[model samples]
Target chain A: MRARVLVRPKAGILDPQGQAVERALPALGFDGVRNVHVGRLIELDVEDASQLPEMCEKLLANPLIEDYEIVQ
Target chain B: MRFPGSCDDVDALLAAEMVGEAEILWHGEHNLRGVDAIVVPGGFSYGDYLRPGAIARFSPVMESVMAFAREGGPVLGICNGFQILCEAGMLPGALLTNVSLQFVCRQVTVEATGASSAFTGGFAAGARLSIPVKHTTGRFYAPAAELDRLEQAGQVVLRYAPGENPNGSLRDIAGVCNETGTVMGLMPHPEHAVDPLTGSTDGLKLFQALRDHVGSLLAA
Candidate 1:
């Protein structure tokens, strides 16, 4: 099974990377960037898709800093 | 200034006194295979350039740290290591520059919330103790919603003592854990105060807890 994990910072955390991207957007001629919070995209090929949830809980994403969704 | 010249201090201290083995990975080399636990020791990695953990996050070593944590290995990040863990996306929330914009160095009291973590198992609920916090950018920031979720999930493992919120962290929080409690990051330097000669020995219990957990896991 293949799983794509979308890991994003928890709602209240400041995303410096996202902020930097937002700052550069207007200069890059794409001024529509708003509320852009950057996160990690991890794609994994797991033996079983049912393990995705456990993977998310154990390591794919940190619950304190990030929330993740597994798309299989 | 960075002290102790590497993670060896933590490793040697843990090994000699705590009955556990800690291997210090320099520059994040070598895959973290055959390791049950990991520690991102405190120091000015990459000279704290750009940001505390900013440069170190991209190191080859972090790749192994990430892989190990993904496989359910217990990981702990202290001081600068904590900043790196957040940057490496292993821990939640970002540690920003201190609100006061000063490098704080002193023994401060902390309250352990007993959030059921590998690092906090030795402490009782609502336990109060003193630990040293020495950093310039130790302020912890997270969205209110995320903080609420963390609290609701019992992930807030350590908190600053009442009226001792040195870094202006939300809810007086000093340290926290991932949902499963295998990963933890905090601003305090528990490794620094592990020895009684360092003014307070409260830090020993933290490392002892990790050692004990790893031992139990091995025995199991």
Candidate 2:
């Protein structure tokens, strides 16, 4: 089975990279974006799908700093 | 000790040797070789492929380092080592990208919060040291509750002086130690400040404190 883990800075955590992109978009004629947050996507193949969250808890995501949701 | 991509290992080793015998422990090894103290230096370990210090935190050697620190051994992590320690769950809080979103490199003043940690044992409370910091993801982040707890417990060992916060760490925190005060991590490169030729010897005080901590442990 393959799973995707989306890792993001926890809510209220500052996201400078996302803010930089959001600022640039307005300068290039895009607008109306608010509260932009950047994150990473990790796709992996594993033998047991049930262990995806455990994998994220152990390695794929840092619970202290990031939140992860697994998609199958 | 040196990880594969650790560029500051030599400087750390040299600084440690000035106080006592020093060595290079491989990141792939599980043995600490009976060292009294450990220094995880700075660099783009694993090429910083993911978040800084994310991958290197799981190195085989870190298991032993964790065990050593848990047993009250003195361990200091500088820059990337600091990031690795935080990612490894050995320290509270996380380092985020700088608020300015730029790689900052400069000499800054950091004050010792207290003589509570093994690394800060040589300095009196409020003793200020000049050290150079160079990094992008150096802003320390912790939830409000955790931040209050760390402050109350004296786990915050060093803080940037007023107006000297290069990376905008929370409350200007520059270094933090575990509850036992045996393990510590900081963003500034103390190894780079040990020599007068480098324009500051304030860093030597930290190394000396490590040596004294080890000596006291051996004597006990």
Candidate 3:
């Protein structure tokens, strides 16, 4: 079995990298990019698909600063 | 010291151990008996891969460190050590990359957070100390409510002085202690500031505070 996790900085938390990209978009001849947020994707191969949440909680994502969505 | 890679100041620490200023023990969990305290020094542990301090949190030695913290033993984490503590869930908040996304290395002034803890006992309220910090990912972050709780509980023990927030830490926080006040994690390197040759001796008070705390325990 395989699982994929999408991790993102929580809302209201500062995302400097995302903000930098958003700021540069207008200068590069692009516009209307609002609320830009940066995140990461992690892929894993596992024996049991049900254990992904626990894995996400334990190591893949830090609950204090990030949120993770697990996909099968 | 048992980690696959050691800090740049390993020789300096060994020098401290040699002079009997500090009785450094290099043992893992099984031999942790009678260990008075644990100092997780600064360094690029685990190559800073997958973000700073993330992979090192799973190291075998941390299990012992966690047990020590649970028992109210004094544990000080500096720089990379601080990152490990946050990753291991031993401390609140997380360290993100600097707002400028550049590595910061220099001497900065930190103010005492008025929180009473074994680590900050040597300083007076509102006292400021000079400490050196070297890190790429040293910005601290926590939710607003949790930040309020930390303040209410006096867990915040240190903060960068105004105009010296080197890494965009929330509330200018430079260091924090756990609820019980035994475990502390900070980005500044006190060990590096112990001698005048390094510029200032302001960081010595931190070690003195730890010594006093441990001494009192032994006297009791």
Candidate 4:
């Protein structure tokens, strides 16, 4: 199975990288874009589909700071 | 313990030796050779490829270190070591990119908060220690409930002094120990501040605390 995990900084957690991008976009004249958030996309191959959540919970994401969504 | 790309192992070893004997335990080996305690020094382990400590947590030596910590062994982690410990689930919370989005390197003042861990007991509660912090991802975060629980349990061993936090950590936490007090992680480079010529020696008391903890364990 092929898997894609979209890892995002959890709500209420500070996303400095995203803020940087948001600020840069304003500098480039693209305005009115708010709540800019940045995250990571991880693609992987798996033999068992059931293991995706475990993989994200264990390594692909940190539950304390990030949330992961699995796409197959 | 020495992981690949660990730049501070020599300094940590020397710092550890100042209080007692020390050695470098490579990440590849599973056996710990019965070391009294473990010190995971700072560095960019595995090049910090996937979130600083994501790759290095699976090293064979960490299995032993985890087991040792479970057995009430004292384990102190510094800088990148702190990141690794959090990723390994040996400690609570995670270190995040600095709010300033810049690598911070400077002297910081941290107040001891009385976890009584091997790495923190050297100072009394409210005692302030001047140490140097050097890292980009040093901001610490945990759920609000978890933070409250930690504060209640006194697990937050060291908190940056007012206006001294380099990374904007929640509650200004600079260091923390596990519930058992045997495992600890901090962003500050205590080993780097162990000498008088380096502007301060406040870090020596932490190394001395580790030695005392190990000695007590041996005598028991």
Candidate 5:
């Protein structure tokens, strides 16, 4: 099975990368960028989708710094 | 010197003590194959220029670090290392400039948050420790709901004492573990205060815990 894990910093967490992208958007002539929080996208090929939750807990995301979802 | 001089300082300390005694690999040449555990030592790689770990995330070493973590290898990122881990998406959450907007350097009291990870297994639940935190960007922030989930899951590894809240982190959290408790990141320099002559030896337990955990895994 193929799984895509979308990981993002939790709410209220300050995302420096997101902030930087937000700042750059104005220069790119793309305004209305209220807030941008950067995150990670991890693609994996697993033997079984049932292992996704365990994968998320073990490697896909650090629960302390990120939240993640697995799309199978 | 991409980051700050502190990274160099921590590197020197680790080298002097042979913290791991493992072979060191240059940036891209190693792919973390057959590696047991990875240590993101403290250093201002890339000079801490963009953000503490912003630039280093693109470094060659990070490719190996990420791969290692993905394969379930134990990874520990200290101080600036913690910053890099977050940037590399190895850990969650972002560490921002201190809430006070000042670099804090001092010994602070920490309480174990009942985590049972390779890093904290040696300590009893609710163990109190004094470790030195030195950084301007050590404040930890996460959404309130996520913080609640972490607390409920017992993933919080260390929290600052009530009166000794050093960086204004949410719930005074000082360190945390991944859900499985294998990966960990913290702002304090446990490598710095590990020896008895260093004034506080509480940090030794962290390294020892890693060694023990890895040893047990290999034995198993």
Candidate 6:
């Protein structure tokens, strides 16, 4: 099975990378883009999907500052 | 000893030992059985592949390190080690990129908020020390509720002095300890500032605190 994990900094947490991208967007002629946040996508090949949540909690995302979603 | 990424921490420890700062018996990750305290030195473990400490936390050695912390053994994580501890769920908050989107590498003053943990016990309340921080992602963040609990429980051990919070750490938190005070994670490199040759020895007090705590424990 193939699983994808999306890890994003929790809401209200400062996302410098996201902000930087937002700033650059205006110069590139992109307008009215608001609320940009940067996150990571991790893909993995595993045999069992049941253990993915455990993997997310243990390594893919930090519960304190990030929220993650698993897509199969 | 664990990885080549943070050899500077090991070099600093050796320098400290040579100066009689503390008696340290350095060992590799596999042999932490008789260790009194575990210092997870700063480094880009696993090349920081997924996240700074994300992959490294799953290393076989970390299993022993976590068990050691759970057994009330003192665990100190510096820089990348700090990142690992947070990822390991051993520390309270997570380190995010600096709000400025820059890698801050310089000396800043951090103050002791309280003398509750083995790491900060040697410093008086509000005592400030100069330490060097070098990282692109050092801003500390946690849920508001968790932050409040850390503050109330006196687990917030260190904070960047006013106007010295280089990164955008919430409440300027530079370091913190667990409720039991056996585990700690900090952004600055205390090991790098232990000698006057480095222009300051303010970082020595942190190591001194650990030595004192472990000494008292041995005596008990």
Taking all chains together, each candidate's TM-score versus the true structure is: 0.71, 0.97, 0.92, 0.97, 0.71, 0.92
Worst 10 residues of 6 chain B by lDDT: B19-28
* Model 2 interface Cα RMSD in Å: 1.1
Predicted complex 3: CAPRI docking category: medium
Which candidate tops lDDT?
A: 4
Ranking by lDDT: 4, 2, 6, 3, 1, 5
Superposing all C-alpha atoms, what RMSD in Å does each candidate have to the true structure?
A: 9.0, 1.0, 2.2, 1.1, 9.1, 2.3
lDDT of 1 by residue, B156-191 (tens): 999999899888787898998888899999888777
Every model: iRMSD: 7.3, 1.1, 1.0, 0.8, 7.3, 1.3
lDDT of 2 by residue, B46-144 (tens): 998778888998899999999998888888999999999999999999999999999999999999987488988867888999999999989998999
lDDT of 3 by residue, B1-220 (tens): 3444448446336433432355444424335656677777778877877667788788877887888789888988888889988998899999997888788999999999778887898567689999898888899898889899999999999999999999899999999989989999999988887777889877778877877888888899
The most accurate candidate by DockQ is: 4
Q: For model 6, how does the per-residue alpha-carbon lDDT over A1-72 read when each residue is reduced to its tens digit?
A: 988999998887777788898999999999999989989899999999999999888777877778999999
Question: In candidate 5, what are the lDDT values of residues B109-209, reduced to their tens digit?
Answer: 88887778888896877798888888888888777887898889877899887888877788898888887788898988777776677788778778778
Q: Which portions of model 4 show Cα errors greater than 4 Å?
A: none
**Pairs of colliding residues, candidate 6:** none
Which one wins by DockQ: 2 or 6? 6
- DockQ of candidate 2? 0.75
Query: Which pairs, if any, clash in model 1?
Result: A12-B142, A12-B143, A13-B143, A64-B92, A65-B92, A65-B93, B28-B61
2 versus 6: better TM-score goes to: 2
Worst 10 residues of 3 chain B by lDDT: B11-20
List candidate 1 stretches off by more than 4 Å. A1-72, B1-17
Q: Is candidate 1 or candidate 2 better by DockQ?
A: 2
RMSD (CA, Å), candidate 5 to true, equals 9.1
DockQ of each: 0.09, 0.75, 0.65, 0.83, 0.12, 0.83
Say what the interface RMSD of candidate 5 is: 7.3
